[model samples]
Target: MATTYRPPRLIIIPGLHDSGPAHWQSWLQSQFRDARRVQQRDFSQPELQRWADRIASTVDHAGPGEWLAVAHSFGTLALARYLDEHADTPIRQALLVAPAEPDKFGLAELLPQQRLRIPCTLIASQNDPWMTPHSAQRWARRWGASYSNLGRVGHINSESGFGPFPLAKRWVEVALARAAREQRPLHASFREWSFAI
Candidate 1:
């Protein structure tokens, strides 16, 4: 079924320093033609609204039934904040990795009980120098997002040594395959996502 809606093009938003050719985001874009980067004026500014506005701009341009946002670090938090305000927007899916901090993104609403009903894969690291697995789990549970800990791989960034994370591609593949079947994740357990891939 692949959702009659095109599940939007994939948009990659980086945090702090942008991902270069060697980073996973860059690699992902290089591998997937439908994938592209979300533009931003500055990554240095601590202001989350500026980044949020850019993300919103991309979302605005994105037609219905055709958007899958892949946000890393601060970008993930920015999207989360935006969702808090624009909860009704039609986004197909989201893949949020290591949200570095909350205060920086102004996502003050996320508590232990809040859930981000969208289908999401919140990847975390057990020994991340920037965050603890507990926080990541708390956030995932709060957002109703499934959490996957990549062992002790740190933040799962370039600094963490992940070069073309194959798991991400597999995740997308599963999402598309499941969508094609028109089966809601609520009735499924992401069991197909268990491939060692």
Candidate 2:
């Protein structure tokens, strides 16, 4: 008898204003066969509770199999909050890029202060106005997530010229490969593809 392997579903959680068509997140979604983007009701508003609730709703309807999430900017904050509130989550691993500072939205105390149980990688940039690199590293530590600094890429969004980013694609591929090899929940071990970025 042979066993079947299903790749983790991709959950694309974009930021406050939503990822534009040219944004890397959008490009990442296009590369995956089983991918779903979380749609916020109002992209212009910064309602933390509503945003976090949307994340939960999206996950609830994600069907079957574990999920690998890629969230950017304010979406990272909402994802963190969702993970904090829901201990038993379907999200096996996450790639949180250019996370906006919780303090900027007056939500520092609302999000998880302790380490997150699920494995994640947090990529930061030296010149991202939304969050300082130091703050990004600190939050990575707080969430028990691996951290990477991308030098001076601004916010790692469309404005940063990050359309069709190969690194993001490679990261998801490596994660799915690792999950298949382990035959367990997905874990974040990005050392193999660190040089590819």
Per-candidate TM-scores read 0.82, 0.91
What is the C-alpha lDDT profile of model 1 across 54-76, one tens digit per residue?
Answer: 87787677655556677888777
Give the local distance difference test score of model 1.
0.71
> On residues 1-197, what C-alpha lDDT tens digit does candidate 2 reach at each position?
95687879999999988999999999999999889999999998988889989988988887767898999999999899888888889888889999998888899998899888688899999999999999999998999888899999999999998999887888898888877767644543433322234
Instruction: Please identify model 1 stretches exceeding 4 Å from their true place.
Output: 1-7, 103-113, 183-197
TM-score result, candidate 2: 0.91
Model 2 regions lying over 4 Å from their true place: 1-3, 184-197
Using TM-score as the measure, the top candidate is 2
Where's the lowest-lDDT run of ten residues in candidate 1?
A: 188-197
In terms of lDDT, model 2 sits at: 0.88
Q: What are the clashing pairs of model 2? A: none
